[model samples]
Target: MIKRILLLITLILQFSFLHAGIVILNGLTHSYTVENGKVYKGKIAIENTGSQPQSIKLFLQDFSYTADGTTHYTALHSHKRSNGDWIKFNTNLVTLKGREKTEVFYEIAIPDHVKDPGSYWSVVIVEPVEDIKPSDNKPGVNITSVIRYAIQIITNYDTEKAKPDLKFESVKVEKEDGKRTARIAIANNGNLYCKPTASLEVYNRTTGAKVGTFSSLTMGLLPSTSKTFYIDISKVPPAQYKATIIATDEDENAFALNVELEVKND
Candidate 1:
């Protein structure tokens, strides 16, 4: 009963976050292909879902993440490849009435001195100034939940000259929730961003027969960042096997790692 109650609370919190009073209508990622010494214009659309008025503050920040699920946010221009200095917004704060929709305009001015063909990025954060609290007055404790959204702004210059370099760091298998999973850690070592997909091919050691082939979900990897790919291997039969793990990006850049796998199914 306690576990079920906790799960209910978790679901409610997730729903609240997804259905926030202030929402960004333009999606989370805004990507652009730009040239040096050029100016690009864009806008972010926002809408107030609740009936009451909502005040929102918009700001820029640098964001970084790793394969271990650790994330860091710092001041604008903190990252080496951040484009924070190039972006300018028309406004930083706004108040919206009930069901009011608005748009925020911004521009990116690429400097003439930029000669490198690479990808630069930054994040625009939109947060509500008001805190949402539970409405029940008889509650012993009132929980306040504050929600914010970070929209990634990416600028790619000279895509023909940019290259993708993916590094396969490690691979391992683990059992959890009555299933087997193969996890692979991959890093983006090049100047561009990549969406990498991982695959595992297993072969029986004794018979030399192909056991199975499994693939993982493709995920985006930014420059100097890493992500873990998880492939379900629960259907593979228990046996001693030889396996080849391959990580491939959209550009067909592939990295392979060979390993011996033992599936006890215990």
Candidate 2:
């Protein structure tokens, strides 16, 4: 004789959008440059694209990511820069009909006595509460998956005092399947968050003549956090070269590094 057990899996999806079912109509991120003791307001437009109605539950969670590609959603105020306590949502639960859309509102009240003028942030999670039934009557186990969305709310206080200090931690160049790439890791050692773009310039080691230049997409970097940037170098001919990589934010803050590379087709 044998026994059977059933299992259910729940996963919280991060980022701006989902493919089907509940969709975010407006956007996923709300960024604000705020002043002390001021109240700011915003809204998230959510829609049920599925034919069936959906019940959504909203709440706040602290957000953080690491260089190793680990993301965390912990209790409110879990981080030093978490502004969870400063936010108030209009409602926690909402019901939507098929093809129906609605707006969820919230307000952020900046504290007057906030001493540190940097970045404070949190996330509003919109989760669909669904009662799923097993598709087949099996003797084994069954699984059900639930998807959710995270809306990032970022507030920057005192831009002057919230400047980002970034540094390069590591760089590596690799060749695979006849393609070459450079991976660079960057860390923010400042008190604020910054969106930075990275560019790579290659020069001939023997002649110092510029060979090629490439840039990466912009990504948000938070204080005490780090991210990896990848640049394609497959077009560059196999040869010894010198490269300079620069990372610059929207505010014109730039950091650069120089390295030597020896490339080979094999």
Q: Which digits, one per residue and each the tens of the lDDT, describe model 1 over residues 34-104?
A: 99999999999999887778899999999878888888889976778999999999999989987899999
Task: Give the Cα error of residue 121 in candidate 1, in Å.
Answer: 0.6
Score candidate 1 by TM-score against the native: 0.85
The C-alpha lDDT values of all candidates are 0.88, 0.85
Clashing pairs in 1: none
Model 2's alpha-carbon lDDT is 0.85
The residue ranges of model 2 lying beyond 4 angstroms of the native Cα positions read: 1-20, 132-136, 175-179
What's model 2's lDDT at 88? 94
Q: Compared with the true structure, what per-residue lDDT tens digits does model 2 show for residues 142-206?
A: 65466799988999999786789889888777877766887788899998889998889999998
Give model 2's TM-score versus the native structure: 0.87
Q: Candidate 1: misplaced stretches above 4 Å?
A: 1-20, 131-143
The candidate scoring highest on TM-score is 2
